[model samples]
Structure formats: C-alpha cells, structure tokens
Target chain A: MSRYHTSRSSSTTPVIILYDTPGHSPQPWAPNIWRIRFILNYKRLRYRTQWVEFQDIEATLRSIGAPPSSVRSDGRPVYTLPVIVDPTRNSSRPEIISGPSNIAEYMETFYPARPVFPEGSRAVQSLFVHYIQEVFAKPLLPIMVPLSAKGLPPRSQPPFSHSHAADALPPGPHRERAWQLVKEQFDFLSSILDKNVQDGDGVCVMGHSVSYADFALCSVLLWIENMAPHDGWARIREWNGGRWVRLREKCREYMDVY
Target chain B: MSRYHTSRSSSTTPVIILYDTPGHSPQPWAPNIWRIRFILNYKRLRYRTQWVEFQDIEATLRSIGAPPSSVRSDGRPVYTLPVIVDPTRNSSRPEIISGPSNIAEYMETFYPARPVFPEGSRAVQSLFVHYIQEVFAKPLLPIMVPLSAKGLPPRSQPPFSHSHAADALPPGPHRERAWQLVKEQFDFLSSILDKNVQDGDGVCVMGHSVSYADFALCSVLLWIENMAPHDGWARIREWNGGRWVRLREKCREYMDVY
Candidate 1:
C-alpha cells in the first residue's frame, strides 16, 4: 500500500468485481461503464470484469441474488449493467454494489490517490453529473431502446426517426422529439464548453485543475461526440482534445484490474 | 460547533449558502432546489437561501469571479439556479458547488452523521449518479419545456424565450417531442422502481441505508410527477406516501448550520 493508505482503516485490501454488458449496443452506456473502469484504473486496484451477454443479464442477476429478475414486471429497467461486488462491505455474503457513483465512491474509501474529486470539488462534480443527466442524457432517450436490443449489431443500433416513434419499437413517440431536443442539447453543451474553454481553466467548470466534473463531463462528451446529431461539434471537439484526452488516458492507466 | 465535522479542517462553523429561484416560475423545478434545501435542513445546518432572479445570475457569477456571462456570447445559461457556497473546502474562496448530485455530496462532506452511502456503497453511488444523469434526468427533459408562451408567465419570468437566447427558448419543435417522450421515460423509471421496490432493501441500491440516491430519486420523481400530464404518478405517489416521505424527512433534519 502507498502513503494514501496510511490513513485507511486496516491493512486488508478490498475485492471488487464488475459485471459489465458484453455487446456494443451501449446496453447501459459506453461512457458510463468506461468512466467506472477509468476510476478503477486510476486507483490501480486489482479487480475483475465479467462481461455479461445482454440476454443472460437476467440469469446472472438471479444467480448472484444481486437484484434477481422477479423484482420487475418489465424485466428490471436497464437492469444492472455494471454491478460491483466487494468483500469489504459484506464479509458474510459479499455485498453487491450497483450504479456508477457507488462504484467510484467505493474506490475512494479504500484508495484515495490521484483523486477524482478535489478537496472542495464535491459541488462542482455533482453539478457536472446533474448537467449530464438533465441536459446530455435527456435527449438520448429515444435511441435507448433500440440501443438495448441485443440482436442489433453495434453501430447498427437504430435509425434516427423524423418524428416520435416512426419505427415499430415501443410506439413511444419520443424519438423525433429526442432528435429535435438533442440539437438544442448540443448547443447548450457547446455554450457551456465555450465558457470553460474561454475561462483559461485547464479542464472543466471549476478552473485550473480537473475535478470529478471533468471526468463526468468527459464521459458525456464522449457520448455526445459519438452519438449526438451536431454535425459540427466544433467547440466540443476542441474541448475534448484538451483535458478530456488526458483524463481518459489517466482513467485507462489507473483502471484496476482484477 | 456540530459533532459532524469529521475532517477537523475548520473550526469556524462552516456556512452553506443556497441560491434559489422560488415559486416554480421561470421553470417548475421546485423539487430540484427543494432537494438541496431538504438535505441542509435535515443535516441540521443553519444555512441561508437567497431566491435568485434569473436576470441577475450573470451579475452574481461575475461578482464571484466564477465562469461568468461568457457562458453565452453575451449572457448566462437560461436557468442556472442553486449556487452553493460552502466555506469548509477552501477558506479564502468558497467551494462553488452546483447541480443536485454535486450539492448532495457537498452536504455529505459537512454533515455525515448518517452517511448517504452505506458501509460499502461507494461504487453503487457512482453508478447511481451516472444512471441518473444518463437515464433518469434524460427522460425528464421532454416535459420541462412549456407548450407555448401561455405557459411561460406562470412558470417563469418575462423574456421567457429570449432570456439567454442561447437556449433558443421554447425548445422549439423539440419541446413537443420532449413532452411526448415523457411517458416513455416514466415507463422506464416505473420499471426500475417496480423492481427495486420488491427487493425489500427499503434503501437505495448503494447501501443498506438510504443514500443520496433516495433523495435524488425523490427530487426527480416529484419533479416528474408535477410535470406529468395526469395524476397518475402511481408508483412515485405511492412511494412518497409510503417510505420516501420518512427518508426524505430524515434528510431534512440534518442541520449542521454555520
């Protein structure tokens, strides 16, 4: 253990297992899982990643007693794409940690080196997360169902609808609207990025050093660059090249391998 | 002053200031702001809330020397409400924490009597935050924009469509799509809640106890319920009356006021 561990509770290390989706349909989300992996990588912790076939997610969840299938009538909405198991939290049964924020925080407890959040970045990071949720993620809904269909090949997820649910999926009329909204969303993000880039700040909103906001921003941005309809994500494209490139590079380097 | 100071960094009784936009006008996002205030109240922290006029946000941003009016070509983002000033992180300059997840974490740092994350809830919280951003918040976007100028006055201040100009307000054709998409989003959230409700955890996915996820979900749920077309927020409505009400109440009492 390093000096950061000097302040930790004990000498024992934690065991973490990540159950990730195998396909490229962006089951839960690529950037979402990537960021978790990045944080794990950043911690340099030894962990394991078990890629689950989307079809088998139900069985896998049931077998581990990690949010079994019977829990939902609609088959557990976006059911646990990234589930973590740690020995530290539950010595008796090996607790299962689900969700991205949970995984990141878990890593912070046992390992705090190369911090994702600065001493005072709690709010900044949280806002970034919210921005992604509210702005970035909002417009992505229409394409999600198509993305979740495992039968579709990666990049072959779904075609863009001119209006709501033009295709025969869920009959949910949010597709055309999502497409329309994503344009506005892209503009909003570009505007925000313009502020950050002009700020003379190294990365994101907080200025100088990159915080969790930077990482979280990076995740959404990666998705935007890949998915959104903004033909010229010019401002965002440049922003990504700056701090994001370095952040993800670090996340990859720091990813803990089980 | 409070027994909650786990970090032992400051002795001057940290202060948390919230910048709020009141009365559901300028946008009916009361639940988002309420969520932050509730946490502060529950943490038992004495904090001040200043209702912000959207027009004045840019001036405040400039005064604070944060990312200023430069956000747009000339003004601020349309509605960047809820600016938190926490003195604990940096003594000279306040930690500018905004957005819900960010604010919640900020609250946790100062008032952790009952942590938002359970024993080994680190990873789960991270994932929750990610999903909220990518999934939950994304779905809510459709209903947030008003149907027309008619809905603006009651919901927001004047110059509704032109306030920031950057938003190109009314969200245009996108708003209609967004509204239609609302049902689909609900369908997804309902599924998640349906499954989790049966898990019998009585807590969020992050831990054995209710974590920030609970608070965050309630805030969004309430927001969605308010924006929803009908009184059919069945799952969330039932939840609020059942268990969420109490958990939310506890979070409000965490008063670590400065």
Candidate 2:
C-alpha cells in the first residue's frame, strides 16, 4: 500500500496514522476528530486514518504492553478518542503520538504551516480555552450520572434511548434541562464572540489572521451550531465570512476517505 | 519585581513557573506544584517561579472580563489552572499553557536542554507516554469518585483533613476499601518499576539517563511517597540523584517567602 503522506523532492514526509472511532457516539461528541482533521487541512498535510473503535484502543495498545491502563482504576481504562500516530519524525522508529491535545502539539512542532497561534495572544487563546471547556463538558448534561447508575449506555455511546429509558427521558425535565444548561452556555459563548468581533480582535483573536487558534475556535463553533440550536444563536448561525460553512465543508473533505 | 518571563526568547530555555495555591495547600495532590518542581529537579534547570494563589488567579483574570468558572453538569464550575507562561512567543501576552502533558510539550519544544525524550526516539517517547499515562492518571484517582461518598474530598474544596489525609484517613469499610484500592495500585506500580529496573531499562525506561520522561515519572513518584508508603517502593525512596535532591533543597530554601 502507498504511504499515506506526501512530500517535496528533498524531504520525506512522515506517514500520519489516525486511530479513530468514527461513530457519532451515543451522546453526540466528536471534538477530538475535528481537531486533527482541521489541523491537517489547515496545513494541507496528508495522513492515513485508521478508525479504531473506542473499545479497541486498549486492546491495540495492550497487544504490545499493558496499555499502562492496568494502573488506572477505571473499568473502561482509557479517556476520550482520536489517537494519532506521527511516523514522519525519527525515521528509524516511528513515534506513536496519542492524546487529542498532544497530537495537535506534535503537528504544530513538526508541521508548522504559516504559524497558527500568535505570540502571547491571551485574548484569543482564552477564547479557545473557553470553547474547549464549554463544548466538551456542557453537552452530555446530567444524563450521564443517572444513566450510568441505571446500567444504561454511556452518554458518549449515544442513541441514548432504550426501550425503558426512552419513556423515562424527555427533552424536557431530563434532556430539556440539559439543553437549557447548554442554551445558557451558548448565550455566554455568543457574548464573547460578539465582544471579540466588536473589537475586531486584530483578526482571529490575535490581531492578525487565522492561526490554529482560529481553526480551533471555528471547529467549536461548528459544534455549537450542530448541538446547541435550541439557544437560537442565529448570530453565529448567520454570521458572515462563511467561516463555519467552509469549516463543515472542510470537515467533509477530511471524512471522504471514511 | 522582576518578571520570571518577560517575553518569549529564541533560545531553548523555558520560562518555568512553580504554580501554587494560597497557603500552599500542604497536600500531595497539588499537581502543578509537584510537576514543575519535578521537572526543574530532573533537568537541573534554573528559572523563576511565579505564584498566583487560587484567589488571586481568579481575581485577576476575572477583572479582565473572563468568567471565573463555567458551570459543569456537576453544578460546580471547573476552573482552569496555572499556565507555564512564556513571553517569547504568542505576541508577548503569555500564551495560555495548561495541562501537565501540554506544559511538558512546551518545555521540550522551547527549552530543549539535554534533549527531552530525544527527537524521534520511539522507545524514549513511549516511556514518557507511559509515565504520563500511569503517574498523571494516578493523581486524578481521588477525583474519580465522590469525595464525601467515598470519604475522599469534594472537587470544590480540599478535604478537611488536607493537613493529614495521607496519615489520618479514618478506619472503616470505605477507608479500608480506598486504602486497599490504593495498595492494589501500588502493587501494580511496583511490579512495573521492578520490570524497569530488572529489564535494565536503566535510569530511564528506555535506557540510562533520566530525560523528561523520567522527570514526569519521578514527579508522580514523589507525590506518591507523600501519599502512602509500602515496603516495595523503598528503592526509589533512597534515590540520590544530586540534581533532584538539589532542587528539593531549593524548594526547602524558598519555603517562607510567599
């Protein structure tokens, strides 16, 4: 098989293998996937993605050595998804790059394109930080607590409705309550975006053009559109610059191989 | 006061910070304090430490239009922590550096003295990854279960026994169960460390010499000694790495200023 990377004449680009679990998941979360996809697209870099379902990451890593998972108390043993392997650096032995944040850092270090984050750009940096916190933590709502105790599927496994659970939950007291929390979160987020836009925050939060920070925030915004429409965040939904629309399109391009 | 890091520098010297809370919270679970302390000790690098106690970090950032805490479904907000602020890059506003893994990446990237983990060294990188997986995850164990329910501290406030938690966990089924679980974790850890030593993985997991990988592992090791003791981990107890010992001496040296 052809290597899943391209390069110029003098240099050989490393093969990038992304081990992902591509399901929409029970709870509808996939920030880890979009992060890698956007970075690769932003830099126009190529990589081969191998989708490893969530259950398999442990078995895959453990086939080599105990996944360092035996040390953890959790029965599931791993956290989150989208493990990446950067095979380009260190030609002798390819490095197994994992973790969502770690993979992004590796990309920034080895494959920097036009420099994504600005120097000491706290104003912009803080926004992406907030976006990460809100998006990842807010959505699952309170279903996880009740659901897990009752032996239902995890929120991340989504299609949350079971025959018994279906009647037990409504988007109102249970789901609706969670959605209300999310709606409030979106209100908080839109205010920040509005303030940044109002200030014209130099461009993309660093007083310049788009960097990784811009792409990172843009991806989170796309999630908000997909997940938090109940908040009626029409401002972000109808915003100009076509950033969100273009981002979703790019996400499709990233997903074509799947 | 002289700023520890005024701006990003072109050299490979990281701007380090020994993050702490007000009162210095005499507990082993203070992840940031131990991590940076461990890195500085392991690398034997000299830099300044900036203290932003819990209340102060909140007060300053909030006065700038940032929200102090965003509510999670748990009903309490998870506030962010100390960033390894670098002045040289990100436009001199101090890029937001959070997470132990991310901070390590920042150090290895900018201040790469003695080559942390060695570029493209798979064995070395894997060791570091293992260290992160085992040690970092260990620190999070307390937070994994409910504090009051499990007799551990709640997320929002430190345990009332913060002064004596390691020594004074009350005797009961819950406490015995927690201690038994902790002991089980230690047994597993001892087995792995024995493999490291017996397999002659040497000073580091990959071979002789403690790089950043060792630093990350050793920091957690130090945290654990403060947590509880077992007969098996005695070998690490007597470790006499002069640089590390010197760094701890320095921590002792700076005990009163804050």
Candidate 3:
C-alpha cells in the first residue's frame, strides 16, 4: 500500500509539506524525520510527505528557500531533510521550518492541542531529546550508519560512504565493544524509565502520557528495527527486561506512515 | 542564628529528623541535604536538622538502623548523609529514608501536596537530577572539594582529604581546563532552560514552577556559594546571561536555612 494518502481535503485545512528521504519500504525510515512524523501524527495535523532523494536534499531545500539547518566547519551551510512547509497560517506563502526541534516547536505554537511538550515541559524534554541524540544515537553511528547506508540507492550512497569506511567495525571484538557502549547508554536510560513504573504501567519517558521525549526515543527504535532487524532489533527488543519493546508498544499509536 | 529550630510544635506534628553535615557557618551547606530542605520548606513539612560529623556518619546512621545508601567497590557499605527519619507515619519508631532521590520520592509519596515531582514527572526529573550530579557536579569536585573541605571541622576532614589530595587542581591551566568543561555543561543546561523563556520569566529546570530538578541544581549552587564565594560562585553566577542568579533568586523562599 502507498503511504501518500492525504488526511484532509485541500479546501479545508491546508496540508503541511514534509520533506523526507525515501527508504526501501513504503514507510519513512529516517530517525530524525520520524521524530517530526510522530509529532505530526500525534497532533493529527493534515500533512503530506515530499520524498527527497539524499543527493537532492540540498538543491531541493535550497530551491524552496529553506534555511540551512546548520553550518559546516569549513564555512558552508549544511542542509538536511525533515524540513516542513506549513501552509495553515498562509496558504499562499507558507512558513519554512528546518531542524527537528524547530519544526516540533513550530507545530506546538500553531496547533496548541495535544501538545508534544505538555505543561511547559519543552525545556527538559529538549534535554532528553538531546541526550538521545548525543549519547544514544552517536555510538550507534558505527554500527547503524553502514547498515543504513546499504539500503540507500547507489546515487545517494556517497555522502555516508566516507564515514562508513572510516568508522564501521566488522564482526569482531571492536564491534562487540561498540555494542557494549550502546548497551551502557541503554542501561542508563532504562534506569531513568524505571522510576515511572511506580506511577503506572505506561512506559513513556515523561509521566503517564506520551510526550516528545518518548517520540524522540521511539524514533531511534524505529530506525534500529528498520536497519538491523535481525541482530540489532532482536537484542534491543529484549534489553532492560523488555522496557524498550514496551515503550515502542506505547508509541504504536503515533507510528502512522503518512 | 543557630539555624536549628522546630517548624511546628512536637505535640501536633512529630518533627522529621534530617541528618546533615555542617560547614563553617551555622547554615547547613551540604548539597544533598539542601535538596531535602528545599522540599521540606516547600511542602511546609515540620522538620529539624541533626548535624552529623563526617567521621560519625556511618555509626550515627547504623545506630539508628538506617540502610546503607550504596555499596562501595570493595563490598563494604557506603554511608552518606541526607538521611531523614520521618516521624509522621509512626511517632514511636520513625521511618528512615536515605539517599537524595529516595528522600525526595518519600516526600512526594507521603506529602503529595505541592509536589516536587509534579504531574508524574518522576522519570524525566530523575534524568535531569542525574545529569546535574554526574555531568555537572563530577567535574566541579576538583575545584569545589578542597575548598569545601577547608570549611569542615578538623575532626571531620579525613575522609575528604584523600580525594582532595588526588583530585584537587591548582590555579593554573589544569584548573582552567576543568572550569571550561564545567562551563560547557552549564551552557548545555542553560540552552535547555532557554526553551522555557517562551512560557514565562521563571528560570526553573522544569516548568514555571520550581520542581525537584531545580532544587537538585540549586543545591549545587548553594554548595558553591558556601565553599567558593569569591571565584567559583562569582564566575558561575554571571554565566549564561545571569540565569543562575535568577534561578537562585526564584528559589530564595525555600532556602530558609532552618
């Protein structure tokens, strides 16, 4: 089944355009994009995905006049996917929001209901998101990046190939060491989530409700399941006494492809 | 002047006994104990401080049958302060709660009003508290530990002396590097708190209200101010556009000393 169906009619609510990268499957697979996708689905906003190839990201985003997400060390603007053009405010000239957190903040400002950052939790939630990105996702780059790059088209494989060559570890002691570091990070996160079990059965990063912190983590879990289903996903699904699996189950409602 | 007084009469509400270490001043300066003090003052719980010398911490806690906070590397029990004996549940044989987070959880459980972990935020709040303790406080030990040991009575200074000798950095490039790392951690935290400015002017770690996360951080600020008012506190108070000073001001009501 195609994952490109529109949620609402164009005459009523103008759909937001999400620039995403395509994967082997019909569903979107990028972790950062998944974060925004979770928010978009959770908010029940009318939106459509614009699949941009990895090579065409810079040109496509630049053509749309979307600002650079960050600056490169060598004084060049770095353009990445997961940029959104929201036409709800002004259907003629929509607002372009780049970066995952920036787009999440914009959505919170415009859609005010079913908030991702509930009850002024934007600050601490951002910290949690940052921790996942830095401490959790960073170590997995060696293992996941190469596995992820394998699925990309030949034309879109150059950018990731450089890091994949330098950082990728074969099945050996080094790979085991890499997995150990990732496990330690997971253990730290699991300890934090253990505190919430007393409140209820829900395994969200926040209180009992599903917030952006849960989405931030679940996005990575989705990435792992997509890239390394047999080895990575198999082991991670059972880690910390199946806490990650429970968390992913709790976030299953917001896992809509479109 | 003594910083030792009962909040409520012994007949009405049996006062909670807070085990704390003393500094040069009458006010209790230990960071972990200050966390409980903040919660107690915020909840308006009747409690009194029981000063314990560092040398007598193990014996004092063991005599009252308090459980060890943690196990040391060599398998012996590691006893620390911030142990509380709450008499509200049973006046004759009060319950002892050790460890900062444990005591905070106990307070949130029994005295649910004006909750420190508001709205089921125990999990994410624990992550924030853990970040402060590990990332923020760990680096400051080189600078703050020796300075703090100076304020302790000669009889209570042995335990800290070993670490002070090994970890204390002199006023040179080594100390500057340590401060730089500390500044980077603060910058990261300030960026997190910066998100809450959109909601209001409050400089809390969580929402507009002061939660346990703020107390966890402010407790460190109190330790720094008590130990290194001239240099360490002075520099930190001015960093991040005076955010720390603003946070301290917001927490002024709960820093009742008694």
The candidate maximizing DockQ is: 3
Q: Give TM per candidate.
A: 0.42, 0.39, 0.91
The TM-score of candidate 1 is 0.42
lDDT of 2 by residue, A171-241 (tens): 45666667566555545444433323322332343332455555565555544444444442344455444
lDDT of 3 by residue, A128-195 (tens): 88878977688888888888787676788888767644355677899889888889899888888888
Comparing 1 with 3 on DockQ, the higher-scoring candidate is: 3
Q: What fnat does each of the candidate structures reach?
A: 0.00, 0.00, 0.81
Model 3 segments more than 4 A misplaced:
A1-14, A164-177, B1-8, B11-14, B162-177
| Interface RMSD values, listed in order for every candidate | 12.7, 18.2, 1.5
Q: Report the C-alpha lDDT of model 1 over A123-191, residue by residue, as the tens digit.
A: 324445656766676756555434334333444334323334434334245545555576566555544
- Candidate 2 per-residue lDDT over residues B1-258, each given as its tens digit: 001233343346555444444331344334445555555444545544555544456555444333333467878644555445554455446555655555665565566675554433322233334435554355335523233222223333354434332344444676556545655554444443332342233234333444544445554554444433342134334444333333233334222211
Q: Which candidate wins on TM-score?
A: 3
| Rank by DockQ (best first) | 3, 1, 2
Q: Write the per-residue lDDT of candidate 1 for residues B185-246, one digit (tens) a residue.
A: 54444444433342224334322344555666666655554444243244444532355444
Cα RMSD over interface residues, candidate 1: 12.7
Pitting candidate 1 against candidate 2, the one with the higher DockQ is 1
